[model samples]
Target: MSEELGMVIGRGFDTWKRNIGIAFPFVLDMLFSGIFFLLVAGVVALVIGIDVFLSFTEGAGAVFGSMEAGENPQIVEIFGLVELIRPYIGLLLVAFFIVVVGWIIIR
Candidate 1:
């Protein structure tokens, strides 16, 4: 079983090596998608106001503060920003899925 697994892994690597051309575009797409997400997040953060965003950071800081004070730190504050973006999460996921599927189909 181990030898068969090794052969399968080797064949997979060989296939990937041979398909570098097809793989490169997917790599670029992933890179661009990550950059785009950061840009959008930054823009949204600005539009929502720094104070509002900082509140989330501050909440996270408070959790750390509690730990420093030798108390139990609440970790839920770390997800504050995620909560703020909850409404947009579905749209982002759907768009990302579409892009990935389209890339696969095109390749």
Candidate 2:
């Protein structure tokens, strides 16, 4: 019975080792991706905050320049968004679609 228990313990250890090996890369990838995403979100939040505040100073309507849509007020002459980003609305739409799809898949 002792020998049988030892074999069971050994098999458990082997199984654990194999699982850890398979999960290691995924764990590392998740860690790096999470850190990167946090940084990106922080930067985006800060930029949008500044842009909205600046827009308020330029006399834009509070409702129109609100953070709900991530509006930027600094480019009043060019409209709300940064001019360079205007042409990439389709890319933004695609990204939004992908995020929604991913959320639905995960959920």
Candidate 3:
């Protein structure tokens, strides 16, 4: 059984090596999308104003208490910023999906 498992693992690696060209584009697509998301999120944060964003942090702190104090974390308050950018979330996801699909098709 151990020898059979080793053979299976070796075969999987061989297959992956053979398909590196096909896999590389999708990997680059994922990296590019992540950077794109961060850039867009930064712009959204700036548009919303630093003071407004800080207010949300303050509210989160008040509700969740300090993480260093070992209190139960209240994550919902922290995620409130998501509500502000909710409209763009779907569009970003759809764009990412289309890019990934296009890469896969082209590959």
Candidate 4:
């Protein structure tokens, strides 16, 4: 590497080592926030039930199966996937809203 590039890289490392302490609080905050959101998501997913997920997976399987066979999945198959997800869209939206509210409150 060139001399100028080496110096810059060394300085960057030194700066990061000196300032890493400043990042700890932000890292911890994100960790806690992620945990909070995951719990909220779990509760929301429970309320949404397994049936929707099963249907979604089934539709996805059909799409993947076609791809695996080197075929472009037809529009109808894509529509089937969308149809499976359509009914649960509202529940998913509510879950997202709840997570957003929780994030705002935490922040």
Return whichever of 1 and 4 wins on lDDT.
Answer: 4
Indicate which candidate wins on lDDT: 4
List, residue by residue over 14-97, the lDDT tens digit for candidate 3. Answer: 998999999899989999999999999899768757756666666656555555567545555455445545655776798799
**TM value for model 2:** 0.41
Worst 10 residues of 4 by lDDT: 71-80
- Model 2 Cα RMSD, Å? 10.8
Model 1 agreement with the true structure over 25-101: per-residue lDDT tens digits:
99899999999999998997687577556666766676666568776445544454456566557767987999999
Per-residue lDDT tens digits for candidate 4, residues 58-97, read 8788777767787766765777678777887897898899
* Alpha-carbon shift of residue 24 in model 3 (angstroms): 1.2
Model 4 residue 78 CA deviation in Å? 1.4
- Please give the CA lDDT of all the candidate structures: 0.75, 0.71, 0.74, 0.82
Model 2 weakest 10-residue run by lDDT: 59-68
Q: Would you list the clashing residue pairs of candidate 4?
A: none
TM-score to native of every candidate shown: 0.36, 0.41, 0.35, 0.41
Candidate 2 residue 37 C-alpha distance from true site, Å:
0.9
Give the TM-score comparing model 1 with the true structure, all chains together.
Answer: 0.36
